[model samples]
Target: MNAPTATLHLLPEVNQREVPAALIEALKARFGDQCSTAQAVREQHGRDESSFEVPPPAAVVFAESTTDVADAVRLASQYDTPVIPFGAGSSLEGHLLAVQGGISLDVSRMNQVLSINADDLTVTVQPGITRKQLNEEIKATGLFFPIDPGADASIGGMTATRASGTNAVRYGTMRENVLALEVVTASGDVIRTGTRAKKSSAGYDLTRLMVGSEGTLGVITEITVRLYPLPEAVSAAICSFPSIEAAVRTTIQTIQLGVPIARVELIDHNTVRMVNAYAKLGLREEPLLLMEFHGSPTSVKEQAETVQEIASEFGGNAFEWASTPEERTRLWTARHNAYFAAVQSRPGCKAISTDTCVPISRLADCLLDSVAETDASGIPYFLVGHVGDGNFHFGYLINPEDPKERETAEALNQKLVMRALKLEGTCTGEHGVGLHKMGFLVDETGAGAVDMMRTIKRALDPKNILNPGKIFAL
Candidate 1:
């Protein structure tokens, strides 16, 4: 119950580890123009969306194929140097930061959709491809990928983090949708797990293991993800509530009664106001729910009617529909930009994002307490959630130069995570344990389980060269 004994200390000074001169020469000879030690490029790969202080890699290797990744890893392994995988560089938990200073395997150039088996409803892609690009490529196939993490993040990054968004309520998270993976182990051995088959009973569930490993065990070079048929009819709507509690209750009931809602998101009053100002939309600034329904026309109507009845019981207003594709895109775009809107509202402030997910039954309690605590803390914050799956985030906007605000935000985040663990839920529903949740991982899973994880890490990567010092301090 007390605050976790561990605490984040001062942002330690970046200790740039020295790369062996021989290794650098070898890399230069092997990669030629593809290898770079340019200060700008290293700095770019050093940080992600997280507010962690930048700790740049010694060099960046723009890999164009799985062979390139394997060779880089093999070379790094030879020298016991850390290798951090880089995709779109949008990771929220400092997953890309060169914490120990090594080589960054930038796979962005590997972007490609290798094959789309329309008959099997599966698509195999190089890890560097982004979700938006994948959807655009396969749009004409009448099949779409459902896992939307709000970021145009690379599929490899999404798999690493086990990301999910609003649509997870009905479709599922990366844990469920990612069918298989081609991983290059720390030893530079290429291996494939799972098949296109709908089910398998072979050996270990290695695919699932790599899906959320956060690149600790191996590098995901290729991914085969399940796809779904585009809905015949789709509708998006926004409903405002007089209070946050009302909005959460509506979501709880809608899910409990099995309304089959495709997506349901909760944006608190402050976030709604920020989005309104940023997106130039005219609407009541109150706690709001953005929902979408996908099915046959009659089924969509029925689901809408059921959800409306549930909403009315909780004082939800009539829905404002975005019936057309363009309208839907615009509305979702604004929702996706909620983080930027919150940050922009605070001018020069940076955001410390908190990802907490609790059981559906306790969603209201967790959120109410969180909102009240942040409100009393006097720190500016915005709230949004994929409430359908009991997952939400609080973007605590603060001037990075102010230590007091930073401390306050971290304290609040710790409390939120502890609360979620108490409710028999996870500290993070989608966001994997990058640098930020290392302590929470120990607290939530206990020392013994984490020890087993370390055992697996050692068995797979004895040198601890793959994304070292990430999920836990080894």
Candidate 2:
């Protein structure tokens, strides 16, 4: 648990390429006021929630349609300038950073629900439509999208990151829910992949390829995803445990027993206290599991009973149910705000988050060992997880000005990732391999597989103008 002396170099070396005046001129001419060179606009679009600092992009293009995106990208191609797609800017990794100077193609203006096939259980939306907005727009249809991701991230950003969240245990992640896409490739050509159909065996599976490409492959202009009917019966509950191991064990047993849990989240004692302080809630300060069930009324009751039995076996306290919709919303909102709460606890500190996922059977081993090591290291941290799916996060709060704390936090992250890999898990469960996890990507996927990725990137983006210097160094 000793802190390593050398820091983990998370940010890539900045190699800003020039954005010629001619390119900016062409953009302004084509889109008029939609193209901006103001420092505020450029700076706002250049960064995300990641703890990295770099120069802002030279210009920002507020694209309102596919044609706008294509034209802007086409112009950038001419100047060999990078075009980094911008969504809601909720990405935890450095996915939105302009490490290599480029134009920030802001798509937040394109928010719209283009079509809703209620009968087919599918909805197509513009890339900038946020998840919350999508659900509100489609609520009249008695259906909703389930990939929450905590943040009200844009659908395009979620699709790019292959994101999942609390309900992922039952409804699945973006990788499984997304049915098709309309992407603007590096050459600024608009192409469609897949269809409204549930499954396909087409050539190359390009839609799957683009789903987790993290904007390195292309700009996601439109997305068609599956939706589910509002559950007939729903119930939410919280159960506190004496220790993290007991809570994790309860989750392991619940999933092992084949319960169809809609959402199962773990918040360690540290995070629980933070959430209480930030949200002004009266939740018990202990390792806690917040869960929800969905199905017929009889089935929901049975599922809850079964889970309660399992929890009791693991020394879990009596359940605290949040049955009303308002109650459930308030509870989940606090859980989503856990990261912000932790950051607020340590003023002027930035969080370096980890996203490692392992098999359901190995959840206890991977999490408990890491918890012990982190405790011994003496770095302030917050732990939360979608443990039903064996995916979790550890947010290490470090002062930006403190070099020693940064090194210690990064060192802890490296050990945790390597341990997850050893347990046959992935370095990233949802967050893509942005600048922060590039080296671990190599370790997890091996040199040969990463080389194959490089080959595909080169073929698609010969000039490397589409989100240059991301995923891997080309």
Candidate 3:
């Protein structure tokens, strides 16, 4: 496959103009200079980090408050134009692509830390607040947000995607972290769900429902998320194994024995080589596990020792520990950049990242099968993942224009999804199905179940005005 020379996603027919003269005049009347149809500006909010490329929205509206969002939504609803919420533009699955092309509701201007209740151990923030900015603000409050997506992605985007990271095993995913949200419905009605309380037998559990809705349901304006006290002691370690099987086996044993893992990331040998070649890191080209322990000093030490013992049982070696703040940050930073390094490693090849989650009991088998399937396909790809949580990523390098490579990658990904579903798992663990994995999701969850989801989507967004052509087009 030849790499695409450029991506050309034109605007939908009804929205060829970035912003109609009437809409622009109305926007100026409502909030002067806050709305613009400037091509250069709209291009900024047009797409996310995913592979799907589209033309810039008709206009980019810099929303400064929830009321502003409501007003924009109401106006757009009147015009019956597609409205796509824009956050940090870091979505790996193209969650923010404006395919129908109405207006990009850029939320960065709405960034505000609403409240930080230390007693409640929760923080309320506007959608524009990035994960890193929120954590920095809460650093002095003795509490910090634990949902780290590594991209400084907006809190709203994180919640919408139900993103998880290296620390998911200990802190949980966005599903568990987001306690409540103030959402703008498609009809421009503002509503709130859940509470700051730790426990609730609340009706419907709408907070959880919207956590991974991917903006097809509603636009999140404000978010309330559970926070944790900064760990008393933080320790990160790197464990090396001679083979991928050994590393996976050690991870399986550690989990089976109930080790409280903060992070148990797997970097296959090929990925390690890629990182070294692309990022210039002095890492051994062997399958390695990047592990972290977070707790009291004694608890951290105990967890480390027990995990190391399990690793040794599976031929683990060079158990290097990084405890200092600098060391831990450096290790995780390098690990987070592993995706970019992998992409850079192969020149002229675009990355096709696939994710799957399996039950812990079947993790080893699933991972082993993945290696075999990749080899059988004869396509070289990089594999790394947050294995502690049974979620892994297969980043396949493919020529964007080559049909054969695309077919091979798709086949391997579909085969992997089938195996995962057979083991009673999900097709996507964190990354949402923006334009990809639509069929895999149906196969995993059954067509009837998918139909029910569509029914709900229609009920909430009858016009399909909210991010059309996303999450299975209506």
Candidate 4:
């Protein structure tokens, strides 16, 4: 398949669209101290963790409340300008690109834990509050938010990306934890969806809709998330496998046996090498499984023993446990930075990461095939995943200036997506289409379902201005 000559369009959030000086002054006057047009600030908002770089917004509006976000949206709409909500800008898929930049609705200023209903095991937080911050604030309440995207990313950004990490195998993704949201629509309408109750047969389930909308449907100003009680016991370990096939096969067996594994991550030999070099860890360069056990002491012991038994059958080594909190934190921290490790392997190279998930039964075949396909090139790459959930990522290293390397990476990604679809998986496990996966979305979901999505998008954002040129363009 030939790739399109899309020219890597420039949508710099700072200069993508013209914002009148008068409009800037007006916003500053109305919000007073909340609006900033400084060059550094604009430049910061212009870029994201995504490989693509675009223009920054004309001015950054540091929203302090839902009313503040609504006001900013109203002003942006009045000028017929595009508005992009800015969280931590950790979006790996260009979800926060200010394609038609106008005003970046920066939500970091609204970092506040509005309420924590421990009785209901729910917490309402301003969109700017990050998962790390929320957990810190709720630490004493005996309840914790378990959707760990690995990064200390803002909850709003996590929700926008429908992020999930190693913990996703046990705790689920943003799709399961986010109970409700307060969204500010394109028309500046404030709407609430979902309730504190555990379950709701409520009309429409709109909250769930926006949770993974990737900032296309609306700008989430507030979020209510379900929380879980801290387990009575927890343990983490790094286990080495003889080969990638053995590691993946053992994971499938564990899942098939219903071991209730909290987290099961696969790190291929290539990734293990990258992590060792990047994090300065001394370990044998082999396929590794980073496992975590969470439950009562007896339950955790039983779970670990069950995993050990399966691993032994696959020629696995004994678990090298990280007993201390610091050890566990450092281990997971390195895992979360896997992409960075891959990118750093080749200086000045950008990382192109793809997420593909397959059925547990086919996980071994899927991973082995994908790993082989990637290894055939011998390109500097890393393979890491939440294997227990059948989701994995291939972080491809590319020199953006070298057209061959870049295009080859894209082609490789497309092929990986194809293989995942063949195995009854999705083009994306957590990351939404944003712009990177638009073509793949069509391939995975077909043109008919894509059409229905476009229709709904048109109905909600009739002007096609909410997030122009994203998901689909008709």
Candidate 5:
């Protein structure tokens, strides 16, 4: 594939709005001990995993229930103050930052599994519940939540970003899994969208609109999500490839052949070395595909055999299988730790993570070119991917003190995003457009579409008091 030239553009800055003293006093009085203006807490609630520099919020409100969230929003709305919703703060983009100062409404304390309709394969949960906690709560019922974004991110945060991870290739993303939602609008009024029924042709798809809105539109208080039955028989395997091209080719073919692969992850040679050193796993350091299949005993065996054959066609070797549950957990746990491993590879350095995704047919072109570009940039980096869905991330580690290194990483990121857009893909497949990708959003959606989005934003949030300065500029 021919790589396109990327021209970087400076994102427009939004002026910081001051929080009135009266509002802060009212919040302190209402929430009592729950309201916090302490510097440490504000700093903790201000930023996420991203490198964007922004001041923390003026205060934080630890909400314990939907009513708490509503009351907080109502107070913020009354003051026309921006309310930034905080979850686990695992967002790679700067979604949680209170760039325009207001109050950070934290929902981490509202974690509760409200109800489970096992018969309908659906569960209603508070916004603060983590994905792992929910699965553990319902695992005995033979149901599981499969969207794992590496971090044990809260379901609300995952839904806000419309996250998808390794299992997304098979189970789909939050966009498909979330059945309904109870959201607090900018006006601080609670509204429920969608229902338990499978399909609906009723009005607008408000649930989907809110899922990836990144808190600009509203705050999600509760979610009703579809769950999957635990597979009876499962098997995990890792196959090493002679080259990145071969591994990507194998992934494309597997997807094309319509194989029911539960998860297929690509780890570059550099990433493999880092994982081996960090996670203490003894595996060949080459371009590798860690995969899993789910089905009955006979079907699982058949799927594994078929995948092995496909991998073999592309110079894949050492097909290590992890059949037992403990073994599988170890393998996946190591895989999930790729980010931390990459970070530790270069101590005292930070990573500028890239989330470019292209069409499956263009996976080889997109990934190979990306790898070559990163290699030539002279910045230390590691590559990992959910190749089954044509989405991947590159953790470009750089010393924060070095301007030249940070510049190189940012330039490379721009080129990668442009290449994905050229290949008919997106700047972000799972990670939503926080402050990091505001300019890219305009590029991907065009000016008119962005205008429509702005119109909607103004319609819903007349005062622009929601999570301001995110997704797009007013």
Candidate 6:
């Protein structure tokens, strides 16, 4: 297969638009202490977990309410200034970068559970609430939201990126969980899409249109999402495999058999070593599958038995169960911290993370080839995945000052993405196309579909003032 060219490694062009002085003055007068032009604050809002960096936004507006958001957006719109939304700053794809020199509209202070319709299994919340915070607040209700994207990412950020996680193999992603939204259009007009109702045949599915728009179409102010009742029985287990291929094959078969596994994650031996060093969990050094099942006690047991048989067929070790809540939390926490563990394994290094998802039938084929290529390149990398859903990540640790390392990592990612696309998968399964994946978006969706996206963007955001220079160019 031909390697992706070096152009894919280039950052998006920087074209800083003028943030007029009058606009800043207007925002200050309107928002009072809520608006800030502090250099430090602007810098914090300017970047995310991604490797790319650009000049910080000219100012930062800490919006505390929908009116605050609307007014700030309205003033920026008047100056044709870009307004990039800021959430928990956990995005790995440069989604929060102010590449075109805009003002960062921070909604973190707006976090609140607006309403909870427990009987309806729906809850409406401000976009700023993080997933962990939401779950903690709703625990007493015996219902919880299942889309946990590792990081305690803001609901708005998760919704904007259409994020998924280990639970997605059963619960689905933000695209399916979000039931409604209250959005501020590019014109600073507040509008509502979808409803508390589970199904709708109403006009357009604007909720979906905005769910993964990455803040390009509008600013999500409020989100209503579906929730699930707490499982009567929950069991977590870990099974080691002789090779990544064997673990992946076990996952493929488990999925094919339609086992209702709640969460199934794959961690290579490299990652296991890193996690063991960092968290001191003393996990066995081998490729393993960390899985969980949720259902009635009988059904959960049946699912686990079936999976164990499938895994054993592929030479997987007997299941090691995390029978208690604390044990399960520890194992899952270690899995979630795999990226940080890998980063710390080599100090003074940053990770170029790749999110490539393939079809279940082709998971072993696509993953094995990428693994071989990465190993041959001799790059220090960590591999992990929500393999039950055929989605995975490879975090390549590289020194920031070393251009050569960056190029090598990008090349590896490009090959993986191409392989995934060829296998009828997506370049990104959860992380949306930020500046980093713009080229891949075109490659995967083709120019015509992207042009149609551009058309919709132009029509909805004529000034290109809302999170400009992201998702796609004008």
- Candidate lDDT (C-alpha), each: 0.89, 0.92, 0.82, 0.82, 0.91, 0.92
Ranking, lDDT, top scorer first: 6, 2, 5, 1, 3, 4
TM-score of each: 0.98, 0.98, 0.93, 0.94, 0.97, 0.98
Stretches > 4 Å off in candidate 2 = 1-7
Model 3: lDDT of residue 328 = 83
lDDT of 3 at 145: 84
TM-score of 2: 0.98
In TM-score terms, candidate 3 sits at 0.93
- Segments of candidate 3 deviating more than 4 angstroms: 1-21
lDDT by residue for model 3 over 80-127, one digit each (tens)?
A: 777888888888776777777788888987788999899999999999
lDDT of 4 by residue, 1-474 (tens): 223323332222333557677778789998987888899989898777777767777888898889998888877777777777888888777777777777778898788999999998999999999988999999999998988766688999888878888788888999999998999988889999998888888689898889888777889998999899988888888889999999999899999888888888888888778878998887668898998899988998898888988899999995787756888877675577677777888899888888899998989878888888888876678888888999998888878787777777887887788888888898789877777777776667777887898887778766555666566665
Error of 3 at 145 (Å): 1.3
lDDT per residue as tens, model 2, 289-342:
999999999999999999999999999995898778998988786689899999
Model 6 over residues 1-474: C-alpha lDDT tens digits? 233324565577799998899999998999889989999999999878888879999999999999999998899999999999999999999888888997999999999999999999999999999999999999999999999889999999999999999899999999999999999999999999998987999998999999999999999999999999999999999999999999999999999989999999999999999999998888889999999999999999999999999999999995788768998998797799998999999999988999999989999999999999999998999999999999999999999899889989988999899999999999899988988887787778877888999999999999999888887778
Candidate 4 least-lDDT 10 residues: 4-13
lDDT of 4: 0.82
Candidate 4 TM-score, C-alpha based: 0.94
Question: What TM-score does candidate 1 reach?
Answer: 0.98
Lowest summed lDDT over 10 consecutive residues: which window, candidate 2?
1-10
Runs in model 5 lying further than 4 Å from the true structure: 1-6, 9-14
Q: What is the lDDT of candidate 1?
A: 0.89
lDDT, candidate 5, 245-295, per-residue tens:
999999999999999999999999999999999999988999999999998
Give me the displacement of residue 280 in model 2, in angstroms: 0.3
Better model by TM-score, 4 or 6?
6
**Residue 268 Cα positional deviation in candidate 2, in Å, after optimal superposition:** 0.4
Could you tell me which residue pairs clash in candidate 6? none
Error of 2 at 293 (Å): 0.3
Model 2 accuracy (lDDT, Cα): 0.92
